[model samples]
Target chain A: MTIEALGQVNVTESPTAGSRSVDCFEKLEQIGEGTYGQVYMAKEIETGEVVALKKIRMDNEREGFPITAIREIKILKKLHHENVIKLKEIVTSDGPEKDEQGRPGKSSIHGNKYKGGIYMVFEYMDHDLTGLADRPGMRFTVPQIKCYMRQLLTGLHYCHVNQVLHRDIKGSNLLIDNEGNVKLADFGLARSFSNDQNANLTNRVITLWYRPPELLLGTTKYGPAVDMWSVGCIFAELLQGKPIFPGKDEPEQLNKIYELCGAPDEVNWPGVSKIPYYNKFKPTRQMKRRLREVFRHFDRHALELLEKMLTLDPAQRITAKDALDAEYFWTDPLPCDPKSLPKYESSHEFQTKKKRQQRQNEEMAKRQKMQHPRLPPIQQPGQHAQMRSGPNQTIHSQPQVAAGPTHHYGKPRGRGAPYGSNNMSGGGPRGSGSSGGGYGVGAPNYPQQGGPYGGSTAGRGSNMMGGNRNQQQYGWQQ
Target chain B: MAANFWTSSHYKHLLDQEDVDMVNPLDKEKGITLEDFKLIKMHMANYILKLAQQVKVRQRVVATAVTYMRRVYTKKSMTEYDPRLVAPTCLYLASKAEESTVQARLLVFYIKKLYADDKYRYEIKDILEMEMKVLEALNYYLVVYHPYRSLSPLLQDAGLNDLNMTQLTWGLVNDTYKMDLILVHPPHLIALACIYIASVLREKDTTAWFEELRVDMNVVKNISMEILDFYESNRMFTEERINAALQKLTLRP
Candidate 1:
């Protein structure tokens, strides 16, 4: 039942007014990370209820409380829905200060000085839509997709009815549990909007991929239709294995959208040309709305709903209420009950690992560019030089073999060899030396040191040895 | 949720007269009578209004702050923490809750200006320290639904949008914050009582509108009498009289 029905007739006095503190919970393993802080899996010590604890990072925030957190807490405190993540309460851990060995250290001296150890307690969920979709062998059936979409719309309807905008609704922001209950989470960006102040809202919201065209073209006066556009994208993504339109940047994102949904014009989107970025870049002529052609497997009812949701005009877009009342939901093979959906361990760990690996690879490539300046730029097959010619050049690109006096000379390893063998030798001193030289101080030292061992066979060998050492040091650095 | 007061926290957490007394039992031991409490609250509400003005916030924010202060006192006793401190802290929290967002420094500065006398003055840290206590006392139910929200819609429905009557009704609604009417009664009834009082003062005929509302006429009559009692006390007890009553009561910070 709903809180309203109970609130009306019953005079059930609340047992207590304030939130119970963190002593009621015991911290567990880290589950996920949010934009501002880390989320951990925790357990209610007394009730044995599993919960998600989001630690609010309060480093250097001289302002008493972050407005983002305050807004989120205030909004979440009032919101209660099965499909919306319930914020149980704000609990403070203010733990005893610990030494490096994890023993409690100095309880009275300075332990209580640190203030921000507060955590937002929420109902624990096993999976998010992104993690579910990205699982290696997982494929959502039509009924399952329908079930998830219904829940999404229901949650959105509740928020919109309550005058709140879930400004950042995307696949990842939609969390799910083992029972397949999809809930809207991460309300850090959500805000309660009033009708009188709709025009002055910020446009820089929602993920770029799921952002609506109106927001992209900078319309602060937009409404619930903005969230509807994201719903359409999520729906399309659910039908297809991949995102329907995965644009790399803002301009390209808009282009990718126009290519699929067809270009907006006066007839389709009145006053479309008036948006600030409309004339800056011209998209090709309409491809005639390929949503039907792209998702030919979708039934007629589903396609009709998708078309209404992806409507170019904000005025024409389907609202969450209308979407909930769509004929598609009432058709054959109706949405599966949330509790009946198949259960699986969340694969969020694998997704996080994949992203971390991708990031490490990019970092290694950057370090390679900085270390091997003498090595000619190896361009990929179809790439142009201008693509790699950005302003982020490392100043440590120049070759320098300085500080020979301080160098504990070791056997020279083969040039361009792997880093492990190089580290076995005395490459540490050379690594530090060249890094110092790369900053220009070692450049002058190289010439001054080159004089002491010059004009001899040993000196020439030392030069080659120094060059090899530099390469080995750069390799070891990676 | 702001538009739906019935389902909001205000209705769900409505307290009776006994419940309010149970929350603050210590006030009875301190010899603070119910009349003296009303006068103290009215003065503090004025102080909150002045502080909100210095920060240039809307009346909605001030009203929310006053409601928060009143709710806090319902759970805490005046002798435990000075109203002088809790009053400004409520405004500080309410400003943020209502989205007006006055900076802590600005709030403290304005508060210092409002209470220039040493007996009532406070530092910025004092207000900040009292904020958490006030929040805890309120049980984090920051959302407050005031009768002012009902005043506009009810007036429009009644076709009684006369300027003088509206202004009088609004002021009377503001004064209701000093009474336990917010704690014990629903916002619409309080609004209806304000309208009834204003109608009687202006000699305007709103009996048909009241009858059409279908609300309990007895409840409306009771709420109006409560406000009239405050007005009677306001005329009878001057500031000196209220101060003498306050002196008899023991208070602590």
Candidate 2:
């Protein structure tokens, strides 16, 4: 969709009854909950312009903004790509986000007047990529897939060149506007790459299902190529109507990949044996199956490109730029124009209900645990502290608290930022050859030909993958 | 920070007249130039240090307070907000942003006990209110990249690190910040010459050390000149100038 179509979401002027009348966005029902806050649809009080208001809930003023929220805000504030979401204004949220002065948060960056509930005013988006793909009447032709592939790549390439990696590159993370434009949305995992030559410090959390093999195998220090691999998975899913690799876990996931691409012998992918978990998994000889076997309905060219993208070695995987450049995108029939792509604003009641239920469930669970059963005793603050690796790769393994999925914020942070240099296993993609032989975080170099517990076969695939360091993304958010 | 003229907030607000300049000291009836405030700001860096240091806050927080003091001056003349009120307010906001919370009572107690000044009467609570205003004025772009982070390395790269060079370099950084060296010269140059001067003062005589180095000699010269002029103008070894600026500034109650 053209960037101009962002306004389609606010076609009807409805402001929530609670909104100040001066704002005049006739409130519609709630849209999706924002990544870290509440969201509602409203029309411009003056020009009748419609927009989405996201009220950010930063629990503690002393602790400051959530890092994920900060990451999203800082990136969104500066990014102006056609395929990116735009922040119109940052109003402090009204309901519960007021500060000691009782001022609604005008903006997260700005204090006081915009305090209480920090509101992020965004240009309206009609639907998300998941919804567009799931539209009951929608059917994607090969050409259309190519078109999306191109747009997705264009956006990803833009992100990469700007040193920002949209690590969570999945269908749901891509928002479709009223026109057919698909803009990249969530940036919680995005980070600026160093201006220096190192590229391995960035790739930690692309979603599983769409995650690259290097990530699945455990190469934390990988680069933009991991994102490219996801684009490949998403591209295939766009054509297949389901996840290309729906592995129950990382091992199964790798088996699914090997079934199509065949076992790694270091010929196709050079650094197989050197990976940290290389000795763990034994890739069984299941007579490699073809992509056609897995996705028999896809066109030959689509299968071919999928094969290139789904390559185990990220270094050899087809790039978003290259995929956009492929014959599959350009030949036989051209993809439909972005504007002509189908548009349907499905009722968001289900998503809204799910979010509300999740929040309720979390709160209830918290209360119940507190009131009844012997709760996990609240340990002192340092109980959860894991030793982090220091500057010299001297393993500290600082237990990192799991990053939030619950928008529960902590104290506004102060002086000490966690040291950027801390890395458990060189912080590279776990098993991909970059594993820390420096610290022996990997399994022994000798490949184990059997299961982790005795000879209970799942054969080679089970050994090397998920044997240890099960910290990979596995794309298991679901 | 590097000379990010195109990108720094300083460049964005330098000549613009959109903001409320609380310290309209330029005497609008007499009509003054932004250049005048800019220079005075350079001078005020010394003043802020004396005050901030008196309260025992981190130099980082002090620098932020000083930068806000400078930023506020860009739009408003110095005469608008009493610099005394503005200074403490900037310090308060800087403390919050820097994650160093000083209790208002303790803050007021220190201020009142330190100088015993009857003018600019303020309790800790009033300082907190002014902090919000300063935060609003600066727009919370608080990821300040100071020259200090870049200076030490610059001094070392100049082949200046010798016995006790690190200590002298730090002292130079601490003392240089008392003036507008930050406003005019980049950080590394100041770090280098301070090391040079320390070498000279110690009779280590490393004059030849600079001859072979390649850099903007003017920026280096500019920084040292600032330090020298500041030292000559103020008795930094004592708190005389701070006491003077405080008394002459006619602070608000």
Candidate 3:
């Protein structure tokens, strides 16, 4: 029956009882800014508990609620584990407080009546894995890396068992409290996957360096194996103190992966060639598996487990549960208890250091740009040499050029190219095709002649390139 | 925890019947009997289900919406918030939570078209305004585990995988949502109870399969009785009876 008529159902305005209002919380300071919004350190006046208040950016969000916020909230609500970051509660405040003290502020753009500013309250963490790792002269002990990995795997295992795929598992996303406990955070890209619901997930997830081969080849129907690949990358990065595959672009990313692990054939990954983007690019040459040689210091057991986790075929990759049960975790150099790890009196020390380094790099780039207004900012020494050897030849030979007389000498360090000589004259496709195949395929092959612009490489989805390897957002209460 | 019902928020936060009843101790003051309250809730569930179906959302969305409405009343009395407003709000939020994600404007359109009357018309703003209250009352615990997730597997394991048997068992599980069984029992046990009830209705002997499963049959029996009791008691209640009770309940507010 069509129960159609007209009667105004007057909903009684209940007195606000349990809304943790702005008056209840005293804002402390702005800690960090995430992709969605800025996070602030706040203290609950009643309980006096310090929390990271992540303001959900609703300014231009024409869509009712940001999908990432909704996904994170729904996932976090169901998850209750020690290693998983807790979402204490969602609280609403009067839109846009003027000061950090959160005093009775002026009317915001949404006006005084607008109470739609949603803030997610999270337990404050001190150090993120990225900040800790990026700390100058801060080298992680084998046991310390082990402890972090163990916690990461344990938290990841819990998420997987609950059918959630973290999708993003970089160092910065892993938060460490003062107790040295590491908890997985930033589930903005995460979602629950089920076999019955074969949803085609977006491939543009997980920062490029940590992205899996299956994802690089555009496999949309991936599972937890995608996350395992990232864990392997993090494990390797922790050990080596540098990203194993630091590709400049998508093709270069694939090339770097193939250079170290050897190119995947049909036998290795049954449908390797059938992936949507598979035929578009091919690793220049066959290379021997050299993870063992590259990580020469790692124990055999660790290498064995790493190999399994970094398997070219996602179908054959080790799961978080299997990786945890590996001999490496159980063997010599037992994982240090989280509490035993050394603590930094100032947790923000690393954050400040990272910011300073980034600032210096920016200043250096700006100074160099001013020196040669016509020249593109020189990224590599080799690029500078390429510029000098051009028509401006010999006429404007500057002091910097004289200091590095053999600037061409820098070509020997062409990354991922075992045989660097192939990038030069007379170095045919054969010349560099086997130094795990040289930069000739990626760089010089493009006839722009002056070498590909440095900015293009740096700007090519670097967030996707995510060499932010250092500036990972960490919300530390201290 | 979403996968493991024993450790899920559903188990930890869901209240028992007594506590749920305590939330609205003023029901008698509003001149509605406990039985009349049950009928009103049933009608509310039907209303949510109808709205959800019109939007072409999955069954899980409808179940979550109904559960949200029930949870809202477990803390606040019906007099505090009208069910007519809360029902649509729950459905709108559930659609987003379940990832079907219907537009608020579309929901308002369908809700007004279906439920609007001279005595009870709503605007899009009303639905949006009520949405926040529903979220607050739910305490933002949006994830809900349903028997259907576990029921399909149990049905297959019991060798009752035929379309007819599957549909019948699935229908039984949906009906169980009407009671507090979902809140009190693990989803697997609820699935088994529904399967048991479905088997009896079909006159199919699944005793051998049920024995294979090492579950507490006592719990299953209690669950079955709860569903049976609901059916027996509500058999005599009609739309007119529920409407009369709802008129009194809504009159005071």
Candidate 4:
């Protein structure tokens, strides 16, 4: 019997029948590839508003819908904050229509072509933090870094208070609009966790470089402290102009973290040896934490906060709320207004990576042309030329001007392909080549811009769960 | 939102008693009365429970799946969205949304094995297709705050640490799902109502504890009355009555 035979009657007039059709928005250039599918920059036909339409990939979904997409939509719907990316209404495309490129749609389920496509509409942002930082000759001033950090912490604090753990916190996921307003995006890895310590959350979350030491040692039970570790790494990256720990794999990742943060032991972390992989990956020798020594040039308050955030013990790691209250934020060169930060052309992680790949290809072609004088220069894809001439190209022509000796461009590090890449393995996404701190050198410092900052609006009087409750009962409580 | 019921979609979607009881015009045109609609939903909720048992998901998954099925019928008609197909599809979607994913192939395997009837037997494609429709009908708000999350905490606070009272109260919360109390009341309030019922049955005093919660007792009484009414009427829900209600929907030609 068919679905139609089983009472699949047309109820299009019903208020909940379907969302506004995807026809309302005209598809623009693809901005990024999300965990499921391509994220496109589209313009609304009615309002002329630019939006990021994240296509929910339906092909090969053995289960009905992707759990990651469901979690993202659910979390985004509940979250309403200035620093978090807003998910506009979800829209659907009609059956089997050819795309803008005149290619047949691949909307299918279990090898059977499905009728429509689902697109989660989100407010469009111009640049992600990685793309902005990766720009040649681009450097964030002290105040600018503070501004982004404050926003990041504010956003993260809101998520934590809401009981949502953004398991994936990295440079590419932090989207920055033209107004220099940073928003925490990509909630595919985010899940609502409870205070119950018995709940077994997967340890395989967060990108490799920014992954916390506890997670590297295979601790299944964790909390908001995990995200704080990544935030600390990001804070140090902004100050030093490179990633603090760029390890290649899990074992080396633990090694890099131990080398910087010192190896975890019962004395420092308390019950550290009880962690699942603690014995397997335990350090052979005790390593001294030289955070202050290595970051001697950093502001004293910044160093203090970093120490708390990068604490070997998950229990001791500073929370987003406490981090916001740190003396570093209150010190001189306070975070300026997000609007006052310099507005550059649109630069997403996807686009910049493509641009970097194009440049590498061009350099390779140039060297090959010198070797074989008679051969014509390699013709790159037409799309690459279009991408190269995009608005961000003007900034690309500048020479690699370093801000200091510490600002050398390290090679791009490897990281997990965005969350939800593996459905069955239940592990985190597999590692892919991510451009981390390689292009952070040669950033031109900006003047301390904008007026005295109005302090963060987050964590103030929002009636979040356990907002006023005692935290001593939770395992993550310090 | 999962922790706080106030800002959750579950809170936002809570309907009035009349709104929850209102039968869809399309279903009405198909000769399905208000009683028939309720019976049909109740029957499908049971169907979802059995399917969930076969799939071996948690009680939370079953609760979420049943809640999804009920929510679908609120905006959709049983005539257009068949309760037979919608019931299983909701379980499938809820399993994934709740992070206890059961494959579509497994669901299809169980459906064919459980139901010999052609109407109840759906292939994997049909369930997958209905999943999209269910997602659309839900407006993609899959996060459901169940009374289960609040029950234990309320029980502990009320000092009803006894095993029998806890189990009885938990069963009452489960029974609340068979009705539309989930659609009308906040989850915590529902938990409170269940505790109120259990205290009376076990002959315990929780009035002081309930008072300290600072919630309006009137709403709790209303929800408690609804639960009692469901128990009173469900005794008369015979197999023939369920079949009669199911027969009201116009079958495919």
Candidate 5:
């Protein structure tokens, strides 16, 4: 819709004098939830244009509006590119007196009733990278992967050039519309940086799986190389059909990086030992670099670019601009046009995970009937599995699954079964509890434990991952 | 856009002098003249600075907060937005947007501490509520380009990076917030105007430097004149006059 139409909608539907009310649009469904609040798919009442309405969570905020929301809105306003999510406008609603659960919100700190709600309106997109990649029997052609990677690099290049560090690049933050265009989303952790590199930024950012080695090593002084490391991780995930590194916590996460990218020493990364966490989490065993060996099947040029992106040294990490000029994008079977890729029904990580859970429950029910012919069908699917497996056993089974790299692509080996079985006994509660802090915090109401790939599989699709990591420490806890 | 001045929201939404100077109909109906409106905004800007000092935020955050307040007044009335509430709310929102992040409770504490009058004191709810209105009035275009970002580079380019001259030029850019120069002019032009003023004051020979830069000298001269006019007019703006102008505002219940 045009800007003039938006203005008219504001004037006609505004109940108050100052700003456009949320009455201008109709909320369709709760598509995703983030660290701040719920994200809804809404349609503008006047133009019938679909948009994403991200509620700015304010009910429990003693600090007024959330700082993350403010940063997201401010950064999104400054960014305008075909490859970046568009923040259309901000609309207000009167008296979010009732919280999302339809209960009266906790009394405001000042003992006054909750007054207003803010929703950041953004252009809608169909799929996120994690959701698309997790689709059963879905495999991206080489050209298609190139297309998404190129768009991601271009958008990232724009952000870096604009002096803004996205700080939270992951598969799910890459939103793809029906026409196959990928735009960067979720700038809540984003901040503008200067070329001087003197400022001390928070080292706790990016998802655990995608966080660069420097950030994991507790380096506060960083630049665009941090994002480039994430882009490298994403490129490898796209080619390998799964996450390259899925660590459960900080020490394990750093260990996983050492296993794959090799250990960072003074020779490869000068000043590596000077980082705050170097002595604490230092690897005991020397590990060899295995990017080429692990991803040998990948195209040679793609491997070359990944190697540069996954370099142990942050100083040697390839930039988005330089990565775009990499030969992988220019060689045979080049990156296809975004419009040429095929489209599918709207698939968000939340919806797909729900569908997978439901399907798994049905399959478990069928197995229960076949195994116990005389017993009545268990009413609570989550409880029956727990009753059989026992909680401790179920919990033990998960770490093994998480530790190994089980390639689930061509082999249809009981996808989601291990995770579905742990639903009540182990996975469900742990998943919900982990959402409280740290990098890769799952979205509210979604489980963080995924099928045999740690939390990086089905549950990693929401843009809410990689939330406020301030509560998480980088070094070994004493 | 944060890096590029020409393509920023600040550039796209640069208001004409007439647009920036127009008094809101609501304020005009409340018997607030054009001069009264400008005086109230100037007073609120100072109020924001004082509050920001109490909150211990950077001057950049204070400048951004003042810019937000000014942008709100251009599209809204002080009567509807409540200058007492909007001023602190702008600082609150700008602190978060600029990544400094002062707590709302801290702001409420200082507001109650700074102002004893019932009309000036506001609760957390009032400031939080006014923050939403200000964000809406701004259309969520929160990124602001300031002359401060351009001042140092321009000073270096003009070979005028001496301590006294640099501080004076920086102070000049800070004072430009008291006028409508931010809304009516690009930041670099404003920085150039500050440099021009500082060069004249410090007796620095930068005429050759400015001419070589190949910019519209007339616009720079006009901005310089406007800054001079603001200083001349506000020289006698004491506490009593600020109170009289603010008291004239018909605030919302």
Candidate 6:
């Protein structure tokens, strides 16, 4: 299902008094619903620009999107860019957004029982790359494929170069504008990379199919290569009809990676022997069927580029710049213009989907009149992490929420790594000034300038899950 | 922070340096002005850099902090509350959001040392209290997009190719902390600008490579000039000069 998202919906309609009820949003209808929330096709009553509105019900004390939503608002406010989807604004019957100044500057029009839920405003978009490819009549010639790849690389180039790894680099994450431009959307899974990165990253980012091998083997310390690996998967999927390494689970995903990329030989890849979880698989393994063998009829240049990108050793895999610079891409057959590609009118289901949303929203609004029993106002701090099993148990030991840091709760580690520091540094509670005055002040030494920062060495620090003997390198894409 | 040219803070706040007004927070328009963001910028830098500094992560993490700060302030006004409070709050949130956790205590302590007063503010107890408020105000849009991730490869493409990661990498990281440059150009453009400028200073033959590339020359030049201007004003190198110019302002750090 597809929904629109964009920035700059127009001030004319949003602030109007019943020029149309909030219904100008047209709440056309829902296109899809997922684990966290449901998405709707909405239109601005003023300019009639369509947008996708994702509404997540904060039914429990544990829901984090409220926090995530606020954080996204904060960052998107400043992150103005062409390749990124603009978060125009956020609306909610959740009472007026709390003034940052505390009660000092509360607005008068806020909190009239009519408003209580939250609604995030984004630029309306047409379709995502994956969905575009799924269109019944949509077809890409070889040049068209190259064009999409170039755009993808260009967008990724903007992201990775900015030190952000869109952990989820699948086609679904890349949205295409009607103008033939591609914009990267959904920062819900993205993170900014700091030069002084130390605490091992968590294994929680990208979905399983798009996950890099290092992350699959539980290595928190990884970089843009992880995203590149996903892009490689997406590129391959663009060529093939289905997902590249459609592993139902983690182990299966790892196995599929080993099947390709020649299974981590000590020769092509060194240091593979050092990971704590580096399980010694059969040394005598078969080479991955090269792109040449699988495709059978792909242009040699395309095959060659794909092969290099999906290389087992991430260090050797072609980078976004290299892919763009590839002779195959720049050769006699240049990429096709994005505009020349045919676009399909949204299915009737798209329109019907809009009307259904209106009915459902009215039902929700009526139910909300009495204050939903399921979503009472969060008057106080709410309990988080119901997934907690007796403080500090193995996250993997439990079946779900396996991505939440791999630390043992309770007493901090003694001279070893801090407890549950898989995603953090001290394993102490968040460095927030929860009590009142800024607590982190004057504690850590100020960052000095000149050469590299002093804390750059923290990369090798002991992590909650740092000691895996086998650092699995699944090169499953392409 | 993938290359959206218009909505970014870069196009929003990068104004020509006019006389800065501490009392007037709305003065920061022009691509991205720093004075209006003095509270937010330094607070975010100290909070994020301190956290990342303590954690020993990459400048990538620090850069992420700046990105989050800009992200939060984009749709928000500094007046609803002090950006100082929002700064650390955003940093804490960004840390968690980025999956580079700096315990709440550590972040608070760092803020106490860097921003708050010792007699009334450093009570460790007080800063922790501010956390919830910070979360409430931001409405929790914690995820951020930054430029540090893109710089490395763009330099390679521009033919200014292959930066000395040790120096250039950190240099690019430092540039993010200079101002919210991440809000304007995409991360790689900033990286390219940084590398391109370094090449010019080093007297390297970068012309052949730069000329062969296909990009907006104005964007490259604009990014380079911003960095240069920031470099000239840095306290690390020219505090003596800047301090003389900034002696009139006696607001909180």
RMSD of each: 15.0, 15.1, 11.0, 11.5, 8.8, 18.2
**Best candidate per DockQ, number?**
5
Tell me the lDDT of candidate 4.
Answer: 0.70
DockQ class, candidate 3: incorrect
What is the TM-score, restricted to chain A, for candidate 4? 0.74
- Comparing 2 and 6 by DockQ, which wins? 6
Per-prediction count of colliding residue pairs? 0, 77, 13, 3, 0, 131
DockQ of each: 0.26, 0.03, 0.19, 0.35, 0.36, 0.07
Tell me how much of the true interface, by contacts, candidate 6 captures. 0.06
For candidate 5, write residues B1-253 as lDDT tens digits.
Answer: 3344443344555677787788888777777878888888898889999999999999999988998888888788777788888999999999877777777888989988998988888887788767766776776667777788878988998888889988999999989988877777877799999999988887889889998997899999999999998988877888887777777774433
- lDDT string for model 1 (A1-478, tens) is 3433322221223645555677788878666643355667889999999998876644423434445566677778767788899888777645553533878744422122324355788988887776566554467888899999999999998888767888777776788888888888877657777656444666666666678888788777777888999999889777655455544346765776775677888888999889777887556554455656656567788889999998888889999999999998999879998889989875443243344234434544666768852332233232211111111122233212211111100111222211111111211212323223211221232212212111111210111122332232222211
**lDDT tens readout by residue for model 6, B176-249:** 46575655555556666776787777677777777767667788889888778766756543435333222323
TM-score of 3: 0.78
TM-score, chain B only, every model? 0.87, 0.70, 0.90, 0.94, 0.94, 0.66
Angstrom error of the Cα, residue A245, model 2: value is: 2.9
Q: Which has the better TM-score: candidate 2, or candidate 6?
A: 2
Reference-based lDDT, residue A429, model 5: 23
Off by over 4 Å in 5: A1-17, A95-116, A372-478, B1-12, B250-253
Provide TM-scores for the models: 0.77, 0.57, 0.78, 0.82, 0.83, 0.52
How accurate locally is residue B185 in candidate 6, as Cα lDDT from 0 to 100? 51
lDDT of 2 by residue, A208-237 (tens): 456677776766566678788888778776
* lDDT (Cα, tens digit) per residue for candidate 1, span B92-169: 888777777776778878776776656467766566556656656765666666678779888888888778778989
Residues forming the 10-long window of minimal summed lDDT in candidate 1 chain A:
A402-411
Give the clash total for candidate 2.
77
The CA lDDT of each predicted structure is 0.65, 0.52, 0.65, 0.70, 0.70, 0.49
